[model samples]
Target chain A: MTGAPMPRLPTGIAWLDRLTHGGIPARRLTVLLGQAGAGKTLLSCQIAAARARVEGAGTVFAALEEPPADIIRNAAGFTWDLAALAGEHFHPLDLRPDPDMVFAGDFDLRGMLATLSAKARQTGAGLVVLDGLDTVLGWLASPARRSAELARIGRWLEEEGLTAIVTAKAERHGGPADALGPLEFAVSLVVALERREESGGTLRALRITKSRGSAHSSSAHPLFFSHNGLEPLMWPGGDAPPASQERVGSGMARLDALLGGGYLRGSTALLSGPPGTGKSTLAALFAASICAGGGRAVHVAFDEGPEQSIRNMRSVGIDLAAHRASGALRLIGLQPGRDGPEQLLSEILAAVETQDATALVVDPVSSLMRGGVADLGQSAVRRLVEEARARGMTAVLTSLVEIGEDPASGTLSAVSTIADAWIALGYAERGGERNRTLSIVKARGSAHSNQTREFVMSSEGCTLADVYTAGGAVLLGTARMEREAEERRLETLAALDHQRRLRALEAQLTEAELRQRRSALESEAARAELALLEAAEAERRAAQAERQARTAASRSADTPAEEGASA
Target chain B: MSAAAVALFVAGGAPRSAAALRNLTAAIAATGRPEGTFRVEVIDVLREPGRALEAGLLATPSLALTAPHGRRRWFVGEFDQPELLAGWLGDVLDGEPP
Candidate 1:
């Protein structure tokens, strides 16, 4: 009766706890919600039995929908000892079929709540479970009466120091507005259980629809229920060792330098830039780089075929087939319509694990989400990237940014936060000449050149020229670049001519200063001699006066008061 | 040939119950493969009245797979492929192939 607030324990379910802060914040009517088959009664019963098992409370579960015996049988399937727990300390009251004395006509909200409270007080129970809200809501004839009943029940449940779970069957086929019943506003927590038929089995998605005073799990989490009860399916999101393998160079030396010895063994990078900027080419080359480095790499082509990818990379001289033939690179060309987000993930995971790949290239993840993969939103790509990070494999992601916009200002719209680095390849036009500019927008854990460098791709190879710095700013185009070349030539010639001019000026200034100082010294020396003569006379006179003043002072001190007056 | 398929190939004489369909030697000798030319799934309206209505079947012998495709008319008279007709199905299915 007198301990700290029961630790408000996390019912071991993170999402549920997030909704009610800590396990329903004891002594409150925590209504369980859902449509008819929302597993509302199951949720409440689980809480009741869990409370008894965990906190050793005298728990009571009253079933209104089923016969008490049938309810007990169902609970037995879950192997929860409702009667046993009741035998030790708890008591389960089953009010089914109603009493002969009280007719349906006399039943009302006030009467029902009075009976509920009386039962709670009699049992000294802290948790109360109500099976269905419709029977109770029927007591109210109108909307105003319904709201009043809800408000009264909510307030009474709070005052009784009882955390009651009242479930109402919501209308789900309608919109969310219509799906939410009365308790959506009255209850402290609302967990909407969504179970739809998946391919093989049912997929259960638990969403915390509302929580009055807590941080609920907002994401619709995959749920699992077995004989042991309910739980949320946790993705690979816990603590794991960071990928420590050395990165294989992307075959572009300067690019490698910008990438801090290239991408780490298991890291996902997003290649975002305008179309025709070689995002796919760069991605293929990175994959080829991984195979060249002696580890397996899989190139999942969601948009382009192997031939297109290879031909595109050929511009930069990255031969994918040579590496593929060497038993290093595996290219899985995915027909855009075949798989979904989850399916692609499963396939990718299977391929990487089977291939034991050190790197993976998902060409243009934007296309994969926009058109290729079903069942994945923009956020789903983030989850995939997160999964890749957990596996410690390098995943190279590429995105096509629209042209004519400053890529420097553009963010990787598809899952950029988890990107350890972004290698932005863009095109800039200046003086009617279009040029290719490659810049490392952001590279985590590495120092990179800030200047937008010009890169030329040809049959020879992909190469990055000297960094382009132009006209009081960093330029990435050809016009200012040409102007800079001409200006450099002019500056070189001007520097040589200035050297000659400086030498001639130094000779003239040196001779002029020496001759001028000699003439001034002669004129100033005579004036110095005259000034010294006057100064010598003044010094002798001042010394004599100082000697006299000292003597007068000493004689005055010797005379004291009367002697000083006589002096 | 196995006794089951051999029995299925013979002619039948009378009406039979579905529970006895598993004992092919006696069931097929009495009643040939289901007589429903359109659909061939048996219905025992007496015992499984619920299931019969659910599956939309009549209270008699039924043949489920029946129809025409291209130039070939697949006269699927039996519940399974026939032993004598196996030769027409090709080398893949040898005499009511196992």
Candidate 2:
């Protein structure tokens, strides 16, 4: 093999194909290893059916453990119509061993191999699935014989140029080496399916453990079983979706203003608070706003049913039921403890895709971590947020923080780190009442307010009120109202005091003016008295001169002398 | 038609197939049954692979016995122990009416 790339047969599953780089290597043997009920058989059948249906390639499906009828019946549960292609394009071989089979001497699988080769030639099958090889290997009586038979089968497959999938049970102890034996060394690729019980439900994961020529994803991808088939939840690999600059409303204008003009489109917002802090209410409002704008939204309620959520949101004036009725909003209710995080994430993503929604709300996302592994829950949430962002869908997740617990330190921390905006709702107890308070902890790519506003919910909807700070104490509820009233009263009294001081100053000015007028009148009287006295004195002097008329010559001489003295 | 039918499946001219055929003939002779009582047929799997598959043959050099009532018994391998093969054939033949 001169370093030529191996051709691939696409599995028709997007995520699985991506996981395998292109798909399982074509015309090569691929071994599927898993424990019982690990979905090995289903996966093998799916591949076979997909090859037949999608590529129109003939396929041979041989069931050694399960009867061919049972396999076909089980496959019918999915959307694949295997019955139509049963005879012409798809050949099912029943190779289940007889229960009473006796081995008298040495034997080999040559007969079965020859039969398979003949069948392949007849149907022109490019792919063959040997399900439950472990069951067949159990009959070989010795490990050496099993190995020989497996090697023979591998040779036969290669000689026939058939792309084969051989499924075997993984041993409980040791590793694939123990169960797979010689088959492990023969196949070009080995895919492992794992089913583990986490919390209350089972989680299925698929990993490509060995790929001889291809660069495949090493991480185990979560598997989801839907109506169509097994779908692997691809991790948000590669570069993140391009950041969006558009803004989306938070339904309430005040809250939007607090958030610096609502949330950024394609960004994730985490609403964390204790119980009854209106986290769900805020999430519902956000979803309702999206739907009200003629856009689709998916609200996944982990804590409550759809009806209960709708009924509860009604009290806050958010009519989610109407949006749901209008087909703009899809309300999905899931019990957190009933399923693992992967299942929840799958359902959420499915809903978003089916609804073509632009906004997603996982109300009380913290519930996912309650009874599950913390790391799995965190990854699931991260994947969900990343996927939503990749599709330019705004995601609003709510986390319930215990009262008095720091939201930044515990389970919410993981989610908060990924959230584009984090709104922490809290209770401020003052004046014998606990009032809801909401503060923006962080909002990336936008200028947000740092104030902790009082969050109020009424029949109208959710609103943010400016919190009052009096004497260095944050006042809320009746305390703020009382403080406001007291300040108004003080203002009124100060106004009256100013009026009184003005009147007193006016009185003082009038008194000063009256006193000046009195003084002027007194000066006028004094001047008049002086004039009268002078006139009287002149008249007396004249009279005396007249009396001295007899001495007129002397008066005339005195007057002539006074006149000469004046000159 | 014989009351009982026996088949010896073999891969063409393999030693095991020859030995199994020889052992089957000897076992039938040791049963002391009349010639017309049992019908023996030799099938080469290489020549007739479809018949081998129809017979549910996983290995070559196998023996199959069918009584008149449609009861069948399959024994695998080359039948190295002749006496054991004879005893098994005798028991199977005894189940049929003489």
Candidate 3:
């Protein structure tokens, strides 16, 4: 088989296809191993349905364990339309042995192979599914014989150029052995589906244990089974289109500032919050913004009916009626338990395509967990977000975090990891009032605000108030108002005190000026008095000198004796 | 020796099958049985390849014997091991009347 071109068939599940590197090898025996209720039957049925419907290949599904009716019913639950599939050349064969023939002389692999070959020939089937091969193995005597027979069956199918899929139980004891008998070595590919318990609910996982002649993912990926069928819960990584360096509004300018000019175009944002914290309102605002900008949007209302959702949004002054009427917005309402998660996702995707949506909002994605398959909900949300991003659409998903639950490890944590931005909304109880707060937990590719802003849902739509932190606590609503009022009061008191000090300083300056003026007047008066005294003294001295001059004259007349005294 | 049945198969146009057929014929002749005591049938799988599966033959120059005493044995390989083939045939016919 070396150097020969290997052909592969798609299993129709996106993540599974990616895991198997396009799909299981064509024209080869593939073994599907799983425990009871691990979804092997459903997976096999999905493959057969895919080959028949998608590839236009004739498929013959031979049911060995479950009755054909049950298989058909299950397929119907996924909306596969098995009857229509049969009309289009898909055949379902009941290969279970008759009760009388169970103890008959002989019933072996040869007989089963011959029957299968005949059926394939009659239906011109290119693909064959042997469901419950372990059930057929039970009729055989020994493991060695079963292995040999399986090897022969593999050869026969190869010789006929028919692709074969066989399902075997992976039980430990009392039932089918874990050893897949010869199928483990005989088949070209081996896939396993498993389920385990988690904190939320059961987590289904799918793994490709063996794929000969092709590379495949070896890690166990979460598996989801819903109305669409079985699929790996992992996002198919590259299905989205290329991203553009475009930015869209998040409806609120302050929120946009918090999100670094709003979420990137073709990016996903996760809004996690407690119930009644305006998560849906934020999503509605995001969607309405896109629609108002003349772009299409899809709003998947999980918690409320369409009318109620529209009414609720309208209450916040987000009128979606115009956009809905103009075909710019699509509102899809799904009752959680009525339709499975996969169905809801598909419908949303369909609406996205139909509306050519540039934005998508799944209001309260937590409702996707209603079916109790935790991994399914997680995977579905992840896929929705990724797909929307890939198509260059902004996707905003909301999740309701319960009170007292850590938002970091809540039900939405797994989904939050893939979001381009995570906006955590919650209520702050301050000043005996409850108000919503919005905080950016993480935003990739942008510098976003770290402060928690007060998220207000008003008649004019949702808006973010200025960040308010008081006493080392982020406050909201009445607490924020109270803090602001207190700040203003303090500022007013400081201003009043500053004015009083200025007046006191001014009075002291006035007092000092008065004292300086008085001292100058006193000094001027003293100088004036001294000058007057000096003047009088000068006049006296002059009078005295004149009088002395007269005396000296007289004395000079009597001079001789007076001159000696004057000298 | 009692009557024994043997068959030799060779692909019609294969060089190895022709050489193997010649070696197998010589080994059968060396079995030392009288002409009428044993019968050797030659089948060309190319001309009648469907018969190969019926005879449980998987390759060219395969030989099988149905001994008169109800023993069945099959030998498969290249004609390069003709002596081993002859020895096996001798043991199969050892107790048969001649």
Candidate 4:
């Protein structure tokens, strides 16, 4: 367990070896433990082939449960040339127990160990694997016997300077150590493989339960074994990618404003809403915007198939299909009951790696929880967001609030908590009309509009518009229209009244002007008549004067005579 | 040499085993044979354990290749890689299958 770090023996699966800090330390006993169907035997063969091909190390594999032919045949399926590598660098020994063989008194793995040892020595093998040692170990009567036998095997392997990998079935319900018991302590490394339920299927993961000589990742990293081989799913360094200061637009311009520009690049946003409340539409819009900006995006749909999703989003003015065709976007659909959560995460990672995706959309993360692994679903989603953000990609996820459930709580509620920004969409009814409304519940590291704005969905896309709350209540749809109509009516009435008053004032002004003009005319008329009369009078007077003068002269003559008479 | 057909039976417990079938068939097909010259069948032993037992398949991913010349080859474990399976098949018939 101690010494200068043993020489690293790479497992040939890059991620697996990386997590192990290097493969099993050379010439040390390493135990690979998993359930009955965890593919331990296949892994053993892969190890043999890898050691033979990569390190050019002489290897020997002892199959305890499977026949050598089956091992060779199955190895071929993985493209391993086990047979050719054998007789020179690789030696495979079949150790299936015979049904006819009668056990004499005390049956132990001594005979098996002897055969394995002889084969290793004969081939000068540096690496050896005992596939299905649990079956042999299980035959032992007691834990003590198991411990002794494991110690004996460990010592022998060490003495021969040969690295040995032993496969064992994990206990159904116990600590990881239960599968190996004392043997777990005997081995220098213990790798446990398990299958976990995802959305519609199962995912395989591996954990380094123990590794003596090197620091190894103890996390249960997702495992992939194809015709290829076994490896972990975790990104190296086991952390999210570095955050970027740049911001990317969410398709809707108004929504971008609500989000303080747009979602920050490499940030995670959760859009939670009731069904038919445009949750998916928002995610699609984000993806479409990314695609439009010449950035690649990946959309994983759980509620519908890619075709249906594409059609549905297209109807909302988000042309996901076009982006998909142009290779700027990838659309993946998972059936809740048909695909596991781990499987979903792996495909997401594949998209990120293969396409160098800068944006990801998982519509209705709630559907993934239908697999009943709510916690696992959250973890998987968190990892997806982390990986996307780590690579400076923006991830927009949607979760549907089931009917009658609180809009804020769902299977992926944790997503809202982990997301850098959270947006909630819901239906608001006012005066018998239902309209969608969006609220920015939380936006980390940025100022965001907290007002509940009206959300409109159309073939042109989604937009957030001002909501009228003039009446001490938020108005939407028909109610707002009605209020607007009423205001217009009042405005028209007031304008008419204003016009009536203006006309009356104009009439009064005209009348006053007429009165004043008439008065002046009357006065002028009077003056003119007076002047004419005066002139006439004067003429009369003058005429009279002339007559009077004449008469006066005559009167004077008459008056003078009368006056002389009166005097 | 005569034509041969291979049947691979596996338990559904291991997801990798199913993936292995694809590689197994690809190898058998890579022998320069005409289409339909040989057939490879995959049987999920979990669903048809009775049939698997009748065929004497003892483990998951058991393969039994039966040639028209009364030649039968059986193997166990992961043999999805082509080199060894093809080598064994070539050596068994000494050439191409009919």
lDDT of 4 by residue, A481-511 (tens): 7777898999999999999999999999999
**Highest lDDT scorer:** 2
Q: Please name the candidate that would achieve the greatest TM-score relative to the true structure.
A: 2
Candidate 3 CAPRI level: incorrect
True contacts kept of each: 0.00, 0.51, 0.00, 0.00
Error of 4 at A55 (Å): 8.9
Quote model 1's TM-score.
0.43
Pairs with backbone N, CA or C atoms under 3 Å apart (clashes), candidate 3: A240-A390, A241-A390, B1-B97, B1-B98
Q: True-contact fraction for model 2?
A: 0.51
Better structure of 3 and 4 per lDDT: 3
Ranking by DockQ: 2, 3, 4, 1
* Top DockQ prediction, candidate number: 2
State the weakest 10-residue window (summed lDDT) of model 3 chain A: A99-108
lDDT of 3 at A521: 99
Clashes (N, CA, C under 3 Å) per candidate: 14, 0, 4, 31
lDDT of 1 at A519: 89
Task: In model 4, state the lDDT of residue A364.
Answer: 76
How much RMSD separates candidate 1 from the native structure? Answer: 22.8
Q: Give the per-residue lDDT digits (tens) of candidate 3, residues A1-567.
A: 557646877876566677777877787888888788888888877777776667777778887778888887877856566767874666877766433221211123443454556667777888788888777576555677677767877787778788888888887521235444755567788887776665555567777778787666677777656546775555655556666567889988888877778888999998998888998888988888898899889898976788898898899998888888888889988778676666666677667877888999888777875675555666677777777776888989898888988766856778788788899998888677898888899988888778888888889667778766667888677767777899999999999999999999999999999999999999999999999999999998777667666766675564433423663
How do the residues A48-117 of candidate 1 rate in per-residue lDDT, one tens digit apiece?
6776777766554656556656655566756467656664545555543232111111112433444455
TM-score of chain B of each: 0.27, 0.89, 0.77, 0.78
Q: How do the predictions measure up, each by TM-score? A: 0.43, 0.74, 0.61, 0.59
